[model samples]
Target: MDKSIFTTNAALTPALGYSTMIGLGLFSLALAYIVRLYLVRNTHDFIIADRRIGFGFGVGSVIAVWTWAMAVMMSSAMTYQWGLSGLFWFVVPNGIAVMAMVPFARILRRNMPEGYTISEFIALRFQQSKVATGIVTVTMVFGIILEILINLKGTSVVVSTVFSIDWRVATIVGIVCVLAYSYFGGLWTSVMTGTLNTLMITVPAAIVVVAVYDRIPGGAEAVFSAVGAADQRNLSVLRPDAAAGFGITLAFGLLAATVADQTFWQKVWAIKSRDVSRTFLWAGALFYPIPICLGMLGLVGIGYGLVPSDFGGDIAAVGPYIVSHIGLPLTLILLYVLVILAACYSTIDGASAALSSIVAVDIVKRYFPGTSESKLFVITKLSVLAGGVIATVIVLAGIDFTTLVLTTYALKTSVLLPLVFAILWPRTNTIGFVGGIVLAILIGMPIYQFVGELSGTLAIVAISGLTVIVAGLLKPQAFDIASLKDANGATSAPTAGE
Candidate 1:
C-alpha cells in the first residue's frame, strides 16, 4: 500500500478525454479481428484448431480456460471462508486432472480426431443415440452458460470499479470485445490470445502475491497459523459438516467433472501429437496450485488489520485488494486488465467454438444428412452466435457466485457426471450409463430446486452419485463395447484412421 504511480482517477482516465469504454471497445474489436485473422475458419477449425494446435498454444488455452473469474476468485473466497479446507477446491481439481489423464486422455486423443465437444465424443463413441447426446448436451450447454455468466459478472464488476462506470456497460463492452475477436479469428485467435493472457496474468499475479506478502503482517506464516479458528471442523478433503449440512453424496464429483469438461477436451483434441497432450496434463497437474497461492494472499489480508471489521469479508476481493495494495510501478494495473480479458474470453471463445462445432458436425448432420459441409458450417457458426447471445443475456440477468456455481455443478450432476463415470469405469454398462443419467436428473433436480441446497457442494455430489448408482442397477443394454475398447486402444497417438 505504498508507492505512488497509480493515482486512482488518473489511471482510470483515458488520455485527451477519450471515451474510455469506446476506446476499450475498439481495442477489444482490434484484438478480436486479429484473433479471427489468426484463427477463424470452418467449424472444425473453430472447435479444435482443425486439430493442428501446437504445444504452447494448447497448454496456454488449457490453463487459461481453467482459471476464469470464478476459479481465481473462489479459490481465494474459499480460503477466506474455511482456511485450509478452501485449498481443497484447487487441490481436488488437480487431483481430478491427474485421475482423468491416466485412462482418459490417450483414448480421447485417438478416438475423437476432430472432437468438437463432450456431446460429440459421447455420441460418436457410444451410440450416437438421440437420448445419449441430448442428455449430455443439455447439461453441458447449461453448465457453460452458468460458467460464462459468472465470468461476465466478475469481469464487468472489475471493469466498472476500475473505470468508475456502470457495470452494465462493462458487461456489454466485455462481451462485445470477445464476440468481435471471436467473430474474426475463431479458435486460432482465441488460442493465441489465450497464451498471451496466461503470460500476462501469471507475471503480475506472481508479483502481486510476493509484493503483498512482503508488506503484510507476519506474512504467510502468521496468516496460516491464525486461519485455524476460521474452520469449524477438521479440514477434511470432504468437509463432513458442510457435507452433511449440504447433503453431499459424491466423494469424487470433481473427478467425474474433469472427465467431461469440454474446455479441456477441446484442448486434448487440438494438439498435433498425443505427446503434446501430455504437456497439458503436466500443466493441469500444476494448474490448481495458483489458487493456493492466491488463497494464501487472502489469508494474509485477514492477518493484517487490512480486513474490514464492520461486516463479513469476502475473499473474492483478492483481485481488487492485491491490485490496490501493490503500489508502485503501476504495471500491475495494465497487467490485471489483460488478465481479466484473458480469463474471461479464453473460456468463452473456446466454449462458443465447441458448442458451434458440435452443432455443425454432430447435431446438424444427423438431422439433415444431405446438407453440404459449407452449409453445415454456417449453421454451426450461427448456433455458436446464438449461444453467445444467450450466454450474454444470462449474464445480464445477474447471478451471484453461489447461484452460478450451483447451477453449473448441479446440472452436471444429473447428466454429464453419470455419463463420464460410465466411460471411466469399464464395468459400467450402457443400461447403467443411460439410466444413471436420467435418474440423476430426477433425483438431483428436486434436491437442487425444492430442498434448496443453495450454494453448497452437497447437492452436486449426491445427485450425480445417485444417478450413477441407479443407472448401474438398471438392465444392461447391448452397448457397442468394441468401439469404446477401440477408442481406449487408440488413445495414445493411434493412427488417425483408428
Candidate 2:
C-alpha cells in the first residue's frame, strides 16, 4: 500500500493517518480562533477588519475563498476528462466571472457606500422589504448548503487521501472544525485562519503541479498534445457530448450570476475604498488562473496512465487520484498535512462566517429590530456553529457533489439579476422581483432536469428573458425607498452614494 506521499515509501496505516490529521487540523483551527479572540473581535473588527486589510490578508483571503475544493478538484477533473474544452467551462467563463466583477466593484463601491450586505443594497434600491429578506435567506441558507457540501466531500477526499483516513469520518471532523473556528471569532477567525490556509492551499497546489509535470514525461505540453490528439473537440467550446457543452447552459449561469448574486456585491461593499476594491479585484483575477495550472496536473496524470479513461470526470475525483499515485515518503508527512489543511479549511471557514453573517444580519434582523451590534455578532458566531453542523449533517445524510454544483449558481436567476436591476433600475418592483424569481426557478428546474444543467451564463440568459418579459406585464408596484431603508435601520446615505 502507498503510505508516504513523497519519494518511494510504504503507505501510512489508514487509522494512524486519519487520527493524526484530525488531531492536527483541530489544533491549527483552535489556534486560529485564539488569534481571533485575542487580536480580533468587535463588530467592525470582525465584519470588515477595520476596512484596512494588508495586501497579504486581502489577497490571501480572496484567493482562499475562490479556491474551494470543488473548484480545484473539478477543474483538474476537466483537464483529465475533457481536455481543453473542459477548461472553457471551468476556466474561461470563470475568468469572465472574475472580469465581470471588476467593473461591478466600481459600480457597487460608488453607489452603495454604506451597504453591508447585497440584500441591504437591494432592499433599499427596490423599496421592497421582502426582497431583502428573501435574498439573504436564500443566499445564506441555500448557498451555504451547497458550499458546505462541496467542501465537505472534496476536502474529505483530500483529508482521506493525504492522511489515509476514511472519508466519512474526515468529513465529520472537517465540518466540525469549520464551524468551531468560524463561530469562535467569526470573520476575524476566518481571515486569521485564511492567512495560514492560504499558504497551505497555494504552496501544495504549486508543488503538485511540478510533481505531476515531472511524473508525466515532458510535462505540460506533452500532456496537452497527447489529449489534443485523442479528442480535438475536447479543446473546443462546442462539443457534441450532451453534458457540459458550453452553449446555452454556461452562458445562462454566468448572466444570472453577473447581474444577480449579492455575495460579490457584499464583498465589494466590504472593501475600504474604490482603489482598494479595485486592488482586491486583482486577487481573484490572479488566483483564478491557478486552477487552470492545477488542472493540468490531472491531465498529465491521465496521460501518464495514473487515471482511467472514463474517470467519473467531475471536480471531486482528479486531485486525489494524482496525489495517490505519487511515490510516498516519510519526508512528505508535513507537506501532506499542509495540502489537506489547505484544501479543507481555507474556504470552509470563510463560507461558514459569510453564511452566519447573512443569517444574523438578514434573517434574524428582519423579525426583530433594535438589535445591538455586539449581540448581533454573538448571534452570528453562534449561527456559524449551527451552519457548520447543518452542512455536516447534510454531507453525512448523503448529499452528493453533483447535486451541489448543479444548484450552486442557479441563484443568479433566482435572486441576483433581479435584485441588481431592482437596485440600479427603477422599473424593478416587488411584483417584478417576485415574478422574476418564480420565472427563473421555473425555467431552471425543468432545464436542469431534462436539457442538462445550464451554466451560470446560460441560467442568467434564460431567467433574464423570463424576468424582463414578466416585469413588463406586471407594470410594477412602486416601493418607497426612504421608508424601506428607514425601516431596515440602515446607514442612510446621501443620494445612494456616501
Candidate 3:
C-alpha cells in the first residue's frame, strides 16, 4: 500500500502528469486550429466538412470517433472478466454496427444530400409529427451525453490511476482541450485531429504489445491456459454465459447506439458519395484491431494473476491494472497517457460537432424559422461550448459510470428499432414510429431499472420492432421515398467552402 516509486506503486508525479496532458493535448489543438483555418469556410464545412470528405479522412474519422473510452477500456475490461468470448462478443457487435450503416449512408446521401443529422431525416419522414422530432432530438442529445461519459471515463482513469490527480482535474483539462479547437473548426477539426490521433493511438498500441510480449507468463499459450483455468469457459469463443447474456445484450444495444447516434450520421453525411461504403468498411476494419490488441493486455494480466480487486472493483481499470504490473518506465507511461488522450479527444470533438449540427439544423431553424445562416452558425459553436460545460459538470458530480452507460444504451434501444423500420420500410407510419417508441420506453425502462441490463435492452428492441411492425400492419400506409429528396429545400448550389 506504500505509494512511492521504489515500491512500484506510485502515482505519476504532478510535473509529468500535467506536462503530458498539456503537451499532447494542446499540440493536437494547435494542429486542429490550423486545419480549421483552411477548411472552415461556412457552417456546412464546420458541421459536415462541406459533405466532401475523402476516403482516408472519412475512415480515420469514423475509427477515431467511435473508439471512445469504452472501446479501449471497457473492451479490455470485458475480456479480462469474460476472457476470449468477451472480446469476440464486444468487438463483433461494435464493428458490425458501423459496417451495417453503409447502405443507410448511401440512402441518406441519395435522398437528403443536404441533411446535417439523423434528426433531419426524422423530421422529413414525419413532417406532421413534431413529437417524432422531439423524441429523436432527445435521443440524440442523450447520445451526446454518452460521448461525454466515454471521455470522462478515459481521462479519469488515466489521471487518477497514473498521476494520482483528482479525476475532476482531468475532466476539466479534457473538456477545455476538446472545446477549444472544436469551437473553431467543428467536424473538419475532428477529422484532421482524428487522423493525427489515430497515428498516436496506433503507434503506442503496437509498441505496448511488443514491449509486453516477453514479460507475459507462458507467452500466448500460457495466457490462454491461465484464462481457461480461471474460468472454465473463458477461453472459448462461444462461452455460453457471454454468448447468451452480454453478447446478445451488447449486440442489440450497440446496434441501437450506432443507429441512433448523431456522430455516426454526421460521418455518413461528411464522406463523399462514392466512398460511403468504402469509408465505413475501412473504419470498421481498422477499428476492430485496436480493441482486440488492447484486450490482450487484460488476458496477459490474468495470466500474471492480476484481478479486478487490484483496481477497486472498477472493470474499466483493466488496462491500467495490467500496465501497473508491468513496472513500465515513466516514458512508457507517458506514451500510454498520450494514447488515452488521443481516444478521448477524437470522440469529444466528434460529439461536439454532431451535437452542434443537431442543434443548428433541427432545433434552431425549426423554432426560429427566420434565423440566418450566419446566426445559425454562431449558435452551433455556442451549442458545442454549452455541451462541453454541461458534460464537465456531470463528470465532476461523480455519477455511477456503469449505470450511466447502460441507462443511455437502454434509452437509445427504445427508439432505435422504430427509427430503422421507419427509414427502410415504406409501410412504416408515424403512428408506428411514435407509438412504438413510447410504448417501448414505458415498458422497457422499468425492465432496465428493475430486472436486468440485458433483459431491459432486449425488451426495448423487441417491443419497439414488434410495435412498429404491428402498427404498420393495422394501418399500413406506403410513403414515397422520393418525398425526402427536397425535405430541406437544398439546391445544387455548392457551399461557399467548396
lDDT by candidate, in order shown: 0.59, 0.60, 0.78
Deviation from truth (RMSD, Å), model 3:
2.9
**Per-residue lDDT tens digits of candidate 3, residues 1-498?**
111211244646766777777777688778877977788877778887877889988888888888876577777787887888889999888899888888777777787777777877887787647898888898899879778767876787677777787778878876887788889988888888887889888889878765665555456776667766777777778888887768888888777768889999988878888898889988887888898888887776566566567666888887866665566766676776777788888888888888988887778767776777777778888999998888888778876667766566766887888888877898888889998888888898889779987778778888989999999999998787777775557421223442
Estimate the TM-score of every prediction.
0.80, 0.82, 0.94
State the displacement of the C-alpha of residue 337, model 2, in Å, after optimal TM-score superposition: 6.3
Displacement of residue 227 (Cα, Å) in model 2 is 3.4
Specify the poorest-scoring 10-residue window by lDDT in model 3: 1-10
Tens-digit lDDT track of model 2 for 137-239 = 5754666666667777777766676556778898887776666656666565676677677777767667766765665556667766766665666556555
lDDT of 2 at 426: 56
Model 3 residue 443 lDDT score: 92
Whole-structure CA lDDT of model 3: 0.78
| Candidate 3: Cα lDDT at 310 | 69
- Model 1 residue 105 CA deviation (Å) reads 2.6
For candidate 1, what's the RMSD?
5.4
**Using TM-score as the measure, which candidate wins?**
3
